[model samples]
Target: MTAISTALPAMSRRDEIWHGLRDTFPMMVGALPFGVIFGTLATAQGLSPLQVMSMSLFVFSGSAQFIAVGLVTSSALWVIWAATFIINLRHLLYAANLVNHVRHLPQYWRFPLAAMLTDETFAVMELRYRQRGSEGYAHWYYLASCIGMWLNWNFWTLVGLVVGQSFPDLKSLGLEFAMVATFIGIVIPGLKTKPLWAAAITAGLVATLLHHLPYQSGLMLGALAGVGIGLVLDLRRKKLEASVYE
Candidate 1:
């Protein structure tokens, strides 16, 4: 009985990791074109293949990387840095939502997991934690999702870099549209609540109207607006529930 009890936890952890990998497969597929496009565009923008791969390996942010590559020539170093920083502000919210669940984890586990956290991985982690509760080795499951995405991004980046060297016109191939479809897939499934729909519609309209803004500031503005709208609505709903109970 003692031996069985000891082994079961280990077995369960393995299962959690497996499930994490399995669930993130669709997101990985959605990210495939974006990774390849980033690699190709970075190289075409005069970044060496090593620099391109290094960005994917270390930074691991698809949108920020794309923006960086796009502005590498036209913008100053500080401007590029600031643009990427603004683009990644959403990760702050992602990390905040997860802090309660991961606060107890050791530094070693927390640091790498935090570094590897991305939109898709965060989505997978949030869904799993909602359904399974973060009781056991849930961090291992999060780690699995992160590692799968890291490997996939690197592999496709390499393929794109190599192929871009030969084709030179790879960007015109329309592969980037895959990323749009993928983002829609990620967002649509999560819009089950009224707050979500309001946020999405608000952001979409705001972004569309401000699309002419430089450095994609419109995107950031729209995101902030959406978040603000969602928060206010959520708080009001909570207050109404409290008053009803009273």
Candidate 2:
């Protein structure tokens, strides 16, 4: 085992903080336009500023917030809850990513990381840990990334609120594309893995085939199918590995 450093000298802390700040900038830039759009839309949909900011702060998930706004407009609490549950289901994936990297950390550390986790932070942490093999203050690095994201998310959300009042054409600003592109970029790379590829394709096909299902239930079904297929593939992989050793 690599020995832990006895003390994090001054230079190391500075470097970690620097790395954190540098990595955070791009995400902040990307969030600005999207935040503006969400803010404007919430206003258009008749949500009070208090409601918009409340959702932004407490829910802290854009997709879920968007879905919630739609349901609130329609006054369908049950559907809103159901859709929010489905859309935010990706949190499970984020948790899985955290498990891979920080599961070895103390329970106290791991639990907090899990609570603060977001898709971007999870992706960044996973990428860095995979590349660097989790040495040299990795926990701090992950914390830095989360701090950056949390700040960006809240900051741009506030910007959105202010801009939403001033600019009625926020949707026309086309900021939503950034989020679409980000998710696509993250997802496309996973296709390199056979099991993941199979799961993704199967899920997409199932979702499309069931698109006509009532009340968009197919989305939940697709997620379930994808997760099930992935788990089965993982079991087969483990069985094969055991056979080789036996």
Candidate 3:
């Protein structure tokens, strides 16, 4: 309690934003290639420049929008819509986790911040909230981080669209490696404990085992399994700690 009390006040808005940007850079690397892919694919699928840009602005979700565009090209409207909704189901978890932190903000800020929240942004924010205990203007911190991600994503999307419109080989520019490297950087550090490792391996195996499931249901199931394993392990650990204290 004494340590938390002392540390909370020392963290200001500027410090929060600075650390948020630093923490967010690796994920931004992943977003760059993804944005380029979206831009090139949108052009290849015959969308106009305005429409291609609009997809980024309105949809704001990289994976969902990409899947949606593919479905659109194949005239699979209903399936695409369903898939988009499913891909975005993770946002519900984000919203639930962040509610206590951001609900105190005015509705205007809350709405836009929620709009900007992505998996990467949520992961960073969740760790921060867990560490810092949102006593001050934590919503501002979350927004600052979210804005960094949002602006970078839009900017790269614009660049991708322009390059896509001009060049044919833009997709082969070795952009895919950025995403792979970024994922490794983030996920490897996170595997510091046995529970985290167990959850990750379980999730991977479940995903591979059920890869044949249609409509991407396997992904949702795998995520559920991973979360359940983590929760059960965490609960058992807590019980052990409580017993030791007793």
Among the numbered candidates, top TM-score falls to 1
Q: What are the runs in model 1 whose C-alpha is more than 4 Å off? A: 1-11
Which candidate comes out best when scored by lDDT? 1
Q: What would the TM-scores of all predictions be? A: 0.90, 0.78, 0.89
Give the per-residue lDDT of model 1 (tens digit) for 114-214. Answer: 99999999989888777666768888899999999999999999988998888888888788888788779888988988888899999988988998997
lDDT of 3 by residue, 7-126 (tens): 556567788778778878777877888888788878888888889888888788987878877777776678888888887887998899888887668889888988888988888888
Of 1 and 3, the candidate ahead on TM-score is 1
lDDT scores for all predictions?
Answer: 0.88, 0.73, 0.81
Worst 10 residues of 1 by lDDT: 1-10
| C-alpha lDDT of residue 185 in model 1 | 84
How would the candidate models be sorted by TM-score, starting from the highest? 1, 3, 2
Residue runs of model 2 more than 4 Å from their true location after superposition: 1-13, 20-27, 103-112, 212-217, 230-246
